[model samples]
Target: MNAQIAPPPAAAGWQAVIGLEIHAQLSTASKLFSGAPTAYGAEPNTQASLVDIALPGTLPVPNRAAIRKAIQFGLAIGAPIAPHSVFARKNYFYPDLPKGYQISQYELPVVGPGKLKVRVDDGRTIEVEIQRAHLEEDAGKSVHDAFHAETGIDLNRAGTPLLEIVSAPVMHSAAEAVAYMRTVHTLVRWLGICDGNMQEGSFRCDCNVSVRRSGTEQLGTRTEIKNVNSFRFVEKAIEYEIERQIRALENGEAIVQETRLYDPTRHQTRSMRSKESADDYRYFPDPDLPPLAIGAAEIERERSALPELPQARRERYIAVLGLPEADADQLCSDRATADYFEAVLAGVPGQAKLCANWVLGEVAAALNENAVEIAAAPVDAAALAQLLSRLREGVISGKIAKDVFAAMWAGEGSADVIIEARGLKQISDTGALATAIDAVLAEYAGQVADYRKGNDKLLQFFVGQVMKRTRGQANPQQLNELLKQKLAG
Candidate 1:
């Protein structure tokens, strides 16, 4: 189901203010500040390095690849890339954080203010403001159920590089928040900076939600829903949080400013801990790592290397390709799908609409049924293009093409081979169509007589008979014309 926001029943006189803190793990070979490998599903602490574990006499050095990725993201969003940014130690204590303080950007972020345009489920576009995006190292996992009454710590992710994207509290509904998140998800993947895999913990969201009386300038006390991974869960968590805050205010109870976790099984947000202010974290510049610096040339280099972004591709698909808005949107949702679409178009030029129909219709259904991505589809784009070319040139009817496509997906030979082997070519020959039409008219003589006597509806029956006799391989336009001429006499 598509993620959508439905207003709560008690939300008549109240409004929701939502902002999201998205953590996207950077795609790199090693950790942010050490030489430790950052691969997932390793044997726990085997991947943790001495620097990641905060061993004595160890110092941290920032990964250049991670920094470049952060800059690439900044440029992609049209944000100002800070020439100089400082890393501060965020003082916090957790079981997964081996270091007492997490090294992160506080006052000076790598990326400044930006905005992203999001399309909601209702087809309306809304622009969400980005406050800042800073670089940070991820903490490890605290496994609770791995043991009977004890916990296990996995340090494989402790030092994984992360880009924490913070957005302004400009969203008013769960739907908008989700739309904004999905847009970022697509952008990061398109930029080749982040994998955007939510299940693997490469991408996650912390939703800051609050409710206030409508038409008020003052914002309400907000609670943070931390680390909701999936889009549907994000929407559900925000909806529940919004309704919870509104009910509390209506009942004369003040909403608490705290951090909460979404329990998917229960569909509720429960308090985890009291939210800490910046003062509580005691942010200060790290002494070990010097202030990072970026040059203008580096930013421009990243900018020039970026592929066409999703929004631009979507617009081009609509304006240049003449595709419908919805079709273009779906096509550009993923870079792979969009690339495949263009490949098909390259094979069969001037047939953008037809190419889109086959890709979005037959190709999509085949991928879904076989549980594979477009990259791993049984039928390649060139093969599908070949099939479409045959259909375009009247070698086969649309229905017959579907049959050939199914056969191709099942490891059958090329479309030409299948069509030839099965005698599936459309009967567009004037001689053959006329002979078939005469046979149908002779067999249904009463209907043909009634049709000439002004019962025009019988023409369809005659056409159906001709199609049935031809095994649905008749060219529709040719059959209609020849059948009409035969009935006239």
Candidate 2:
């Protein structure tokens, strides 16, 4: 019980206080402040509404679907749904914002205070506290042509609803931040509130990276890494930022407060601009829209329908299914794969462990290498369950089961149909097995003599001969037992 865990990276004589601001675009049919379509990759400005394009007389309205989604996320994370949250004007003149200032939640957010349990690189769990998750409308894009002169503005993504999830400075290493991001990504996607596609710009992260001493409590100056497009890059960016900061501090140089970009090929973070403080935004209340006021009853309703989260489900799988902790954790890593695992294992008699093996070993491996989900897998759940039942019943050898699995993946028929069509039934009949063994013994009289002379290795030879004689149809246990009895006699 007193096992030593791997300690966090070198103390640097300074403490790193890490925090995260995650922007997850809510899944909805229309834009957040307009009736225009929120679809991606439209003809430039084609989906723009009067409000999105910010016509002189256009009035902004909140999207009801996006509001409900924000509530669902807060409830899922056990965060507070603020009864009173305001819309603020964050003033920054950029071409993407048709409105002079973008409307966002600043003074009071829709949700506040949640926590994420991240698995560190050393297999230890660290709780990354979340300060708040707020709702805000996204701005449009400014497209700069590499070869052309004019800077074009696309209002297609304008007024899109984005849930800004902010984390506290609790993460100590790049690995922990990456794990926390994955947990957040899965939670939003599983709840059907966000698409969680970083490449599609639906879910993105800005990590506040800093470094500190191993035992000190005081904080070090942190730099914010911006627009990390993928999970691998997130970790990479944090690592580079950490080393850069530590080097900067050690070399007697001031760590400038700044925003930075991660170069994927170069694997380093470059300074984007000198960081701007909150005061620099010139924050003011948005006069266009009123505050968000969702009641406790509405929050309670969303919480009631919230499905069991990933961590809770993982614990349940171990306790209910009698699986080892590692196996259960692996099985429940994703909601889709976990659901498929349950479908095949539930109600199957005396097969929980075996079913897990097939799932983790075969199904999961296939999915990972091919980069597909169980839902979209060529093999269906029922078909896989039936195949497992066949395996349990001794209708085919496990080797033959592999063949059956491959056949199904290649668009063959169901388990029974495949077995029948391919003549893959297991030979468990005692009489037929005995006949096959007798033939192997007679043909292999020399090997039989060796096995009888206490050359136990020859028994494997006899089993091989029996299988060859039966064309690999013998049930292994029955074959071994029958072979042993006749050989001993």
Candidate 3:
């Protein structure tokens, strides 16, 4: 499943090729082929059914919901869905595998070749091709520290449905691979197929890395970095592996094809075992389940039910709403954030940039400061929209609005209620501004004389004094105009 696309320029006469295999655990109530619960944090082996444990004479019936989710993912990426796909048994020996073989799709997969456009750190978009996305069952977990010198097996996760998404080896650096991984993670969550929780093992990535000389069309031997959970670790692991391979090659040593593990504590990768090829797995068609047949009607139904995807929403935010690409990308990073932005826009129509700034700036800072998500913020969308509406209406200055926002976040009250109680209304009246200007002129008579004598910068000093007098509620535009007029006289 290794292929190449046009990559970025080589680094120091060497080029690195990277691809990712993302395993997304499907969000279903039950296991793929059994009625066992798929909830996390259950007692050890508490949820494993007879079918999940592979009891003799227990036949598996494929869950229709899992199949439907796989189809949904295929349609989301504009990939063709196979009318007939088969499940095959991949033979392997592991302590966590209840059955001797894992049922997976090999020759005939549920999803065909697809592509995704990912934006890197430098704001350049790279189109990465996907080899395939197949359906499979997950193996149980092995707990090594649970017992004294004895490994414990947890079969609760066995028989869980997973969609393994394989990508072409077209990426040239760690940045590109991380960008592609993030794009897929956002997509599955947006499509409602997977929760995209890397910490909970709901979504994970396996990185395949190789390095070759600058001008050679021939590929180099590759290694697999197995089960990197977080985005930061993925980038670091690939970087270390690329350096390791290149250093080995330069020192007159051939790179070995093997699997490795990333140690976050040591920030290095160590050899896990020798890599296994497809032939080693001894794949064969599963006799327990028939060929999964998906009709055209099913495909159409899933396609019609899809919500407005992230890319489309991003484009609309940019072209129609006149937002910058960076703002749109940040807002559309997740579904809940985008929805909250839209809700604010709904309250105040025609203020796209303002809404984006508040969402990405102040609101974002508060969320990070309190370590809470947008959904759980103390100030919800409607309240924020109301606050923004007042600012739009010239009811309060930008500085005053921030103070109001702080109060609102503290569970005080609405913007209007707080503003009224504190008398923080903007001072835009000409008479009130003129009185403040006159008082400041009389107080700083020497500075006023210097200002008329061509010290134009003194104007700002007077403006600051006026703002202080008004308790930072002075309308900036009005204050400056009236101050300049009186100073000329």
Candidate 4:
């Protein structure tokens, strides 16, 4: 899809123009401009180095890994990778900002002009235009109420690296905005540049929401919703903001441009502070670091290392594996589930549909019931494949296979072992099956006579009787054929 800015659907004659700025923390070992470690959950100031603390005469040196990741992300999104990008100092004052100013990109960012395809729940696909993705250093976190009458500072994240992705205000609805954000989230994680953990503050979004009258070209004043960590919250915050703006307009009140916070509990947005423009930040090139230079060779290396993205993988599953759209979507929802699905396919090649059914059906239910992920599944792919093999070979009926699967999930040995111990194998031996069928025919003589007299539906009755007489051990297909011949005679 071409990179075009399209507005979302209008609500009550007002169009919502939504844009998102997402900060994806780079999965790096050290800080962006210092050698300080970048591990989370570390005690306050323990991981901070002298440079991170901004000691006198401390110089800022760029981390190579973080920059490379930014380039990789740009390549993944088909963005232009700038040969020269400047690191600008954004001046701002906050308790968490130990450096008094943030080191970020402004005029010349590393990545420029990319687009992502967002597929909403209603099957409408829209291309969200990405303005730029710039590399920046994160600030420290403020611990509220850590000490009575005093807050605490944790500099462990002070110098962490981030790639701030800015998008154009084109989405017209909250759902479209969320679809765009989730597509970006999946892209970053699939590229292996970020963990994409919303709970860990690894990936967060800042939403810019505005509303205008239908068929109006002029844009409306936009409010910035800051630090929304989850996709559901992103949708909710935008929906509430749209409603708030419409009410203000209807009541003859002006929509103010400011920053707001989303209260997930109350499902509303509250004003945090007035929005700051670029000029407010006093952005200027940093004197401590020179402009970053990237050669064609470096960009090529990053591009060559890129894996197949999620969208492409989903298509491959549908086309190559012959999986249904819903099944492909569910398997490709996350990397863990996709990897597990492939592992099962590896064990049972040429049975993609069966593998998909089991993975999506019984396996998923078991995992949810046990409160675990696929990685911790009690019955691994190998064990499940073994059970499927038995079912295929007619060693067990479908009903007995479910019993064996249950036993396997409970930590019983392999499927074959469980089948042997329980004697639950299907009765496929013609001699034994014939004897069982004969007894069923003798017991249901009336039904048998009716079947020969053209009551063909009675075939089902005889099959059921035969299966019950054998305690569900008879191979259903074999029982059907034998019963048909006996009833005809």
Candidate 5:
């Protein structure tokens, strides 16, 4: 929910508390409790099955694949897995909900409490406590169209699997909350549980915000902002709400407990409805489906088959590879980017920093320019490593290597072939570089004299002249040496 509110108090009396509820649409072939297809963009009710429509005598059967994915997510966050957990029916009325109740996990959830590290702006890590992650079935869509006098109901999304992750009210600012959301987003995608596509409504965030005086530990009245999809909106909505609460508290007004909708256009929030408590939903154990159970052997199997997680990958990039914190963080932000970086390292071992620079610098620019994902890039990691190797071997200067990269991007051959065809090889020959340096020194006698008279900054001037004379083909290190030798004379 994007909303506009008053600015936060500048004085020392106010502090904000924030928590998040994230729903990740599991990437399963069918719905959580039904055999209906979970594919998007299908016609309205085509994907709904008899079970999805809640026809008489149509009982739900649990999908084992979806449960295994939930287990994978719990294990990734180091959360305890319950051997047995039950599902409940949450009763609510909506036109799109044919069953008039949602089957979900309540008192007993599959995943227990967990913790994850979120990065702040100052390069420090803080732990966000996760309350629980529970499995639930999604409600269908109610589409309101301007062309139609009445609303439309779509049951395709109904019965789809979702993992609702709740977090403790531990964040103190908008930055921390946004960072936590991003960290969770990266994690779910990395674990292959969810696609993490906010635009398609695959992943969404609902934030709980409240404000209190700085010294008090007692909590304040909180409001729930429902389903703001983007990360920027999450930050903006919380910021506006915090300010609104602080201003209200300062004016001796009480905060109302309600559900609000964010207006991105107006930059403000409006009351959607009175917030519902747990009692309001009347959650009860569902009698139709039996309690789901997991064995130790299954948990062990999932653990052993786990892929390398984001935090461990970040640490390895830092401690073992000797990369800086920022570099490590950027490289490990996504699974595909990290895999690409590691592939480059495999091609050119022992050049970790160089590999990081190229990947984060030029390669990133190229990807952004072409509007292509790293996995779909025209240049692969081995090809990039080959180009960097030519630069490392003194076959081309860094300046010339860039042109060769452009040629490769244009679908030219390997770096060596491009270099040979374009006559772009570096001039590392001592005799040739020496003659060029001497000629430049003879022409720029005034500047050469200035350099001998202790104007050390003029060294760059002499190097520039030699580079110009050699048409930018001279090896920079060799030119620097030859310039010093001739100038000393």
Candidate 6:
């Protein structure tokens, strides 16, 4: 339902209504129709096929794997999987489309009606409802460069499978639209369904923006803004468009419903052309391919195989591990890293809190500095588990553990091996700690007397002296207790 956009009781109030359409290229082996390799970076024209070239009599055959992938995505978003779907001709004139009309899903789309919960790493989740997700073949791109007078067509990307996810007009601001887009990107990539590389055009989005009164129910005439390449661009485009619409209304000018292109350098949206309705294309069924049908059994099978979604895993981490909300969110952002963290915690006797602290801090830092993915980390869960076990047992001080981790990353050894090689064992021996404690007491008799007089601050000084004498190898837990006991006298 579209909200009314009349001027509010006040003259200056405005609300931004945004909806997003994201085009995500499906990850598959071959092109949708052409048998030519659907691979990236194959010297120009090497992967082109007869169908790609639009040679007469070359028929299009539906790729079963691509269809299955489309269905998988639909189920992932809880969308309605159409039992029977058809391909339609989206007729247009462009150098990239050799047939002058691109085959796409218009009337009977493969999927419909889904929603995604956008968590912007903020405390709130913005739930953007989905309008539909249609499976379509991507058109090849045309290149017009300053170096060449003639334009060139690259059909290497022709027939690439794409799922266009359209959202309901549930977003109220540019920031909300961006958050929804980011969440969708994260979900698809984490599921290994889409690479989500926007720079290479693996994923892209277009957002529809309009302004309305804060309390009015009527919708304003909306403008469709396209060519939003990055998150920052999406925000800037919406901001400019909203202001433009609001100004037009205030000036007694009608809001024009047109397609606009966002210029990042100028931070503005310029009119590209008037928007076209469905009839403009005259869409019809493709004679080459038969009607597509998805069965109930197949849907059931795919649903059962679906991985644990991000929100579920995040909640589980917070609930089961008692970790802070922010910490849990960070750890669960990556699927494999979350899995590895759970594995290391399984059946461990220590506090899970400490494990999370180490993982989020030192472990994550090392991985980032080395330019490595978590799955490719040199230290695995088993190794980390072994390492944390030592810290819990007071076998090494916290300072020594940092040295041990450095050594482990440098190919030194496991936790035990490094502890031995560096002679970094914790000095937890009560007798040794007591002798050192006695020396500190003698050196600072006044502080000891003050401690006996109920001063707790002097206790830290003793702990520091113990650590200094032991070269940071003193077990802090044991030293703490011993120092407290000695200071009591």
Q: Pick by lDDT: which candidate is best?
A: 3
lDDT of 4 by residue, 306-398 (tens): 887788888899999999988988888777778778888887788888888988888999899989988888888888888887888888988
Q: Candidate 1's residue-wise lDDT over 268-377, tens digit each? A: 99999876552399899999988999999988898899899999999998889899988998899899899999999898998999989998999999999889999888
lDDT of 2 by residue, 247-293 (tens): 88788887887888999999999988886663387777788878778
Model 1 alpha-carbon drift over 4 Å, by segment: 1-10, 276-279
Weakest 10 consecutive residues of candidate 6 by summed lDDT: 1-10
Q: Note the clash tally of each candidate.
A: 0, 8, 0, 1, 6, 7
Q: Give lDDT tens digits, candidate 6, residues 229-274.
A: 7888998998899889999888899988899999999999999887
The local distance difference test score of model 1 is: 0.91
* Stretches > 4 Å off in candidate 6: 1-11, 120-122, 276-279, 347-350, 443-455
- As a whole number from 0 to 100, the lDDT of residue 313 in candidate 4 is 85
Q: What Cα-based lDDT does every candidate model obtain? A: 0.91, 0.84, 0.92, 0.89, 0.89, 0.81
TM-score of 6: 0.91
TM-score of each: 0.94, 0.95, 0.94, 0.91, 0.92, 0.91
Assess candidate 2 and give its lDDT.
Answer: 0.84
Winner on TM-score (3 vs 5): 3
Residue 208 in candidate 6, Cα distance off native in Å: 0.9
Query: Which residue window of length 10 is worst by lDDT in model 5?
Result: 1-10
Name the regions of candidate 5 deviating beyond 4 angstroms: 1-11, 276-279, 442-458
Deviation from native of the Cα of residue 261 in model 3, angstroms = 1.8
- Listed per candidate, the RMSD to the true structure in angstroms reads 2.9, 2.1, 3.0, 2.9, 4.1, 3.7
